[model samples]
Target: NECASPQKYHVDCDSNAVCVDTEEGYSCRCRPGFADISEAFNRLPGRKCVEAVNECLDTRLNQCSENAICEDAKEGYICTCRQGFVDASPNITHYPGRICNKPRKPDDDHQVSHQLDSCNPKDPRCGNNAICTDRKNKGQFICECAEKAFRFDDGSCRLSAACDVSNDCDKNAVCANVFDSYKCQCRPGYIDLSPDPETRPGRYCKELVNECATNAHDCSPFAECIDATDGYACVCTDGFSDTSSTAGLLPGRKCSNSSNECLDRSTHTCDDNADCIDTPDGYNCQCISGYVDVSSSANLPPGRVCTVQTTCPKQKTDLMFLIDGSGSIGSYVFKHEVLRFIKEFVELFDIGLDRTRVGLIQYSDQIRHEFDLNQYSDKSSLLHAIESTHYLTG
Candidate 1:
């Protein structure tokens, strides 16, 4: 009668346990392999049975084979063949408990080159602009971008980045990626001027100039001007050419009349018998100390006929030629000796308007004046007059 009692009259127990009624009372017992999940109860003490936690959920406890997957089961866990893997023996199959073995190629020697091969698509290798190669002897593979290629998430590749780091520019320039290729540029203040400006990094830093050294300028005939960064200026135009180095003229100045460029033997046109005298404008040629210009005109070209000054008078002094006709001096000695003495004395002064004045007188002859000191203005004219003078013998 109690076993046939209404559901409400039946003994109460854990949902996972069966209720057993005895003459004294009712007790709770776990089902098949389940155990009481609750150890302590808040109220009445009784077994609160529940299905045991599947140990397979703890992968550590139910560690399946490398190629297998652990699956939770009614009583415990089961190891099954993972996707792309198969059991060692087809007939040895067990529901949710099959042992897994790595798949083998029809051509057994065709080993996969990478672990990712297990989840590989139809075309496991990389696509355009990418490379797929074996990692090692193991059945595994690695996919990477090829030379100058950029890889996308979808495993596709595209050409790009001919350069990566600055070194890729070979230290010749700055490098930039233009999506498809590398771009190089020179730095500021640098210029290649070549057809292609991106030649090297050095081209960017190369010095650029407007090039003033070669152009001509509007300088004086006595000066040579050269180009400078700011503008142009006279360099070789300074009158002090004699002191300037042969390399170039003194910087930042103009030529002056006082500059004696002719003093420098290397730059003068005067003859050996001539002297180079510097003028404010340029230079001039003059007869040397021991020479005279024989040209008809006072102004003569360089290398002209030059006679010796002969220590002859040169313009600025008073000269007198005195003759002695005394009886003690014989007529022969008087003519030769007296004449010789006059000629020699005359040579000591310069004969010119601004130089010496020459005169002649005969002694013992009543002091007759043959010529006055103001007679000739030049040495040549005075010398000629002296040669033509007649001898007065007393």
Candidate 2:
């Protein structure tokens, strides 16, 4: 037969397959623990067979219960109940039949004694501030606080004093519930006159006067009141100065008259090219000739700026330069720098009798008139006259 002496007769099968002598020739059949690659019962020559796959590795192939642990065996898998659980169907202890379940608690009369025997007085699971008692029921034990004043919070008993409304305390004080007891404290802006504010039965508080905040001071509408320890003081607001002969902090201080801010140089913020004129309430800024006021608003404070006119404005301006020709000033500075600066400055303005007239004067111990405002009618003539002026050092 082909199965006998297979190697010599040219009959070969896979190592996991068996060589069967058929009626015609020979066939290869996979072993009980193996499978053919082609899924055929018998395979021809050049076919293969492989070892069966372990069923426990795949969940669909292993029929273990939900609460059971699976273990791979030689041919299949084994199922056992997990920890803290037991087999529900004790008659069927194998996989696909055994169902896992937790142990049942005492719910009937027959199981009540079993629960009572399990309780250990020394090892009750109740937390602090509470006492544990056996219930002799399905739920075994319960925890309760000892005193009626203490209430259960989280896992412990805490003191809770009863305080609902402010009227429960003195009229001048408000009621507050602390952890252990209730207390009465004075309100803000009031001082407790009692000797012992903590242990006193009723609060006796005196009202601390705030005349500035309450508008109780005899101050004018234009003044602001400043609260002091003994009394309040009155001070005039902005744009209004104190006109009273008395000091600013005095009781009868008056701010009825408007003060002239333009008289004081430090108080006025007028630009160099502008003039500050005092008004009824405030001051006004007036730009000089050949300069334009570029202030956004006229009513705004005195820091108004005046810019030079891009095109010279046709206005009557009699401009004069008083040069210092004293001995302290050197002749070179007078002739070169001084004369050049004057010529450049004169060029900025329109020179004419109707528009702007130019004049020059030299002064030391005595003054000398170099030229009058009516002398030059044109800019070129004015510039030449300024350049030719002599420096008299006396």
Candidate 3:
């Protein structure tokens, strides 16, 4: 047989071509995955065979569905369903006109085919989140959201209460998703005047009332009004104390009494030349008669310094005594201790018009210029003026 011992008999053919022993001699035929360059199969001198083109590279050559994957084989090509898809054809092989459908879930009994025109009552096309209705008269089908709480989106149905990434609420409000719907609520430090604030629509939030600015707070006259979120705060003013039963200084709390700042050395900030005087509104620093106020502002702040008067009338030696007359200093102390000390100190200096003229100033909640240098000319009258000065007891 020429095919059994072709090499000894000088039988030759293409690598991909099979050698067959014919009645005359031998013949060459291309294999399944190759093509014959010369159509005729014979023991010709130059019979050639070449590998066939990959059918999977060209869509027209393969029978794979649009949603399926195509693979090339040595002999032909193969077709299989893609990921997340299923082969819906009755036969196991994927071929032309084959259907690749979405995988069915446990509760997809009511789903219908994706094609609206080819929908069947037995096999609905709508997804699980939707309902499909057959319109026989129109020869078509319709899909709609399953329930009232669902909304139609991008060819599907989703929860109506779902809030969009970009919140659909007012600028001053925040969007919140509830069980069956969404809600818009005002942020902190804001107020909504609508009767049904939670359910009201549109830009309901407005800036809360400024009680401190509008003077709507009931803070005491001796307290400072501080604006707060949705409310106001009352704090005791300087030199005043809150006598309320509660800890914090709330509205209507008593801040009437003046604090004895002079007695509390830690709180007092008076200059050596000035005396600290506790007042109803606050405290003050008064310069003595001999010294002149040289503070930056007209209203003396804390630590105000007083300097000796450089320009005083000629032939006048002004001597001033500043006394603390707050309630902390009792009446007995003022009349005996404070007054006696001043009288004895003045006795050392000559109290006369051209000599060392003396002046007395007492302060508590108010300042009292008892007698100036010009008012008292003699020692006897100046002594009488000092005795007549009564304790203010502020």
Give model 2's TM-score versus the native structure.
0.22
Candidate 3 residue lDDT tens string, 1-394: 8878878887777777788887977777778867554422222323567688887789998777787677665445656555444455454321312445543232344544443334465677766456766534675656655542343223445433333423455676544343223445555445665466544542467766666645566878777877665576788787666765453645445685565777876776677788888765457888777765645322457447566665433445778899999999999999877886676556555667777888788899999988777888887788778888989889
Estimate every model's Cα lDDT from 0 to 1: 0.52, 0.62, 0.62
lDDT of 1: 0.52
Candidate 3 regions exceeding 4 Å error are 1-195, 198-234, 237-239, 242-258, 264-276, 290-394
lDDT of 1 by residue, 1-394 (tens): 3333527676556666666666855555678767553322221223566567787667666756566666564345556444444344232312322444442222325433432222243466565555665546465556655665654444355544344422343243433333333344443333433344444332333543323332334444455555444446665443344323332555434444454667677777666687777765467777777776553232446534445776445334676777665566776665555655455455556566567788887767556777788778876777677655565555
Candidate 1 wrong stretches, greater than 4 Å? 1-129, 134-143, 146-149, 152-162, 165-172, 193-195, 198-205, 209-281, 288-308, 311-394
> Which ranking of candidates, highest TM-score first?
3, 1, 2
lDDT at position 355, candidate 2: 94
Q: Write down the TM-score for model 3.
A: 0.26
Clashing pairs in 3: 111-124, 112-124, 112-125, 112-126, 113-124, 113-125
